[model samples]
Target: MNPTTTALRAGCSRGLIELRQSLTNAGELLNHVLWPVLMLVTLFFVRDVSFGQSGFLLGTLVLPSILGMNAAMALVTMSHLLTVDREDGTLLRAKSTPNGMVTYLVGKIISVSGGLVVDLAIFLVPGLFIISGLAVGSVGSWLALTGLLALGLAATLPIGAVLGSVFTSARDQGLLTLPILGMIAISGVFYPVTSMPEWVQWTAQVFPIYWMGLGMRAALLPDSAVGVEIGESWRHVETVCALGAWAVLGLLLAPVVLRRMARRESGSAVARRRERAQRRVS
Candidate 1:
């Protein structure tokens, strides 16, 4: 194979292996089951209403929003996985070899992005049938929703890279998870941002999560989901514009951040960290 193809394959393989390993170690099955089970149980016994009537009034809308959260979570986990590999000396060994760093990183992105796609399908497909009917209207609306989802994932990558660079161990992941999940909760994933304090709504708008949720809502829900004026005009166009801007910004910054991380990763640093851990455990 050509060098480019070979590099892509190597990167993809490494990424896939890491992704699977991370999921198994992290209880990926528990997470998947937890979300849908919580959602369905609340819908059936806890709430007398149909899916739409439950407090999740936007059941049709919530699926895509959750999918966006899934994308962000997947990217964040991938970032942490990469960091663990680096910390354990895998990255140092690979750096000493003929395998290119760029290829490996690209493979990581591809592998994680593939996992995100699968996660979305797993959540949304059965969700459409079970919770609420898929009602995006025409083929065009479906296309727009798909585009929004892809762009949202693009926007999530840089943030994930930054998080991965900062955090080191499973303990760190536990501490960081709450903050990240809080960000999502406040980002209007569960309800309209307008319901929050003005300051909270303003804060939510600053993150890609808000735009991702808004974009998904725009795509899935009917015009009624937004304000009357916004619904009348079909505000998805604005969502596209806003999300596109975030996607562009994330793309521009992700590589620079990742390169800085690669530069910081070294055999000596990995060894020191490992030695310290050993000392602590002993």
Candidate 2:
């Protein structure tokens, strides 16, 4: 086989192995289940509450919006894993091997994206049972939902990888969570963006998170729910444009950033990072 093909296969196998381990590990499994379960419980209590005079159930609106937010979170997960791996000498080990960076990245993508799919299923299945007003009966709805999910992942994952490459440490990674939480608040994960101030709506639209949530709402909510959306429509074209722009920007930057990060990884550097981490723990 060609060397590139060999590396790709190796990376894929590595990803699958890691994914299986994550699924089977008790701690990791709990991490996957806990949040979705909490969200479901929240949905259960609010499933019947009306969204003001919009006549939409708050739970029904939140279900898909949360899915989008979770999808966008792929960015954070990718960045977090990259930082951890770098600190633990994983990136250095890969750097010493032939085409190691390629294999490492491919493997990470598979594992992260695979884990995301499982997480989504965990949230979505029980969510469907708890919420009403979903447009799931039609084949088109499922297709659109799938497309939106794919676009969402594409939009966020590269940016996440780029973020991971830049942060240099887990402590820096923790700082990112605050801004992400703030974005979630303004992005309409649990409520309609249209309800926010006009400037707030525009500000939310500047990031991929809002488009993701909006796209998801377009997919799962009924036509009647459109009234609560910006422009009183799903704005599918704008969603595509926004997510696509981010995808392009992230893809363009990730390689450059990852390459720079890889260049700086050496045994002494990794050791120093470990020492710092240990001191923090102590």
Candidate 3:
């Protein structure tokens, strides 16, 4: 089989494993799933509120923001799991195969993409029908939303790979949750970016989540929180340009980070640290 096909097959295998595991645990009511449900209910009660149909604007905005949040969580979860896999010798065994990175990344894309689809269906679909109603009327808008979600996933996957390669254990994984949640809060996932200060908004723009939220807002709303008109020449061009830039940067950086991480696997320092972590956990 070709390298791509081999990678793809490995990816499929990993995705199936993750999907079955996720579905099993997803049955429980946890903050990740529960919060969105609560928010959707809250929004439904106040559907008539608007700043120029900002109810519809907010409805559309929230979905992509949540998708961005999903992307962040996916990155963190995958990083931790991948690190554990590496420490436990799973990655080394996998690397013996052809195109390890291709296989690993493809698998992650499938798993994360699948999870996000369910997340959107459960969170956004109801919000659109219950709150925004017919605001999302056009096929173009739906296409735009899908494109933005894909960009969000593409941009974040590299970050996850980088994290996986860099972090060596579960403690580092716990530490990641703070920064990730902080970024999500500042990215305007739950609130409007406009409500945030100018400097804060600028800072948020450094991450893909903000751009994803902005692009989603543009696609979903007639009016934009970022002060640009969607589908306008400049706006449309900038959207394509920004997403493309992030995707390219991620692809370039991921391999470099992974190679460095692979080197650490054999070092005495890592082994000592891993042993200490195991002792602490035990």
Report the poorest 10 consecutive residues by lDDT, candidate 2: 165-174
The TM-score values for the models, in the order shown, are 0.80, 0.98, 0.80
| Predicted candidate 1 versus true structure: per-residue lDDT over 86-161, tens digit per residue | 7787766666666567566776787678666666665666666665544555887688778876777677765676
lDDT of each candidate versus the true structure: 0.66, 0.91, 0.68
Give lDDT for model 2: 0.91
| Best prediction by TM-score | 2
Better of 1 and 3 by lDDT: 3
In candidate 3, how many Å is residue 165 off? 1.3
| Stronger candidate by lDDT (1 vs 2) | 2
RMSD of each: 3.8, 0.9, 3.7
Spell out the clash pairs found in candidate 2. Answer: none
| Model 2 agreement with the true structure over 80-166: per-residue lDDT tens digits | 999999989999999999999889988998899999999999999989888878999999999998998888888899999999988
Per-residue CA lDDT of model 3 for 110-199, tens digit only, reads 876776677667777677776543337789888988877787677777777778887766677778888887888888776666677778
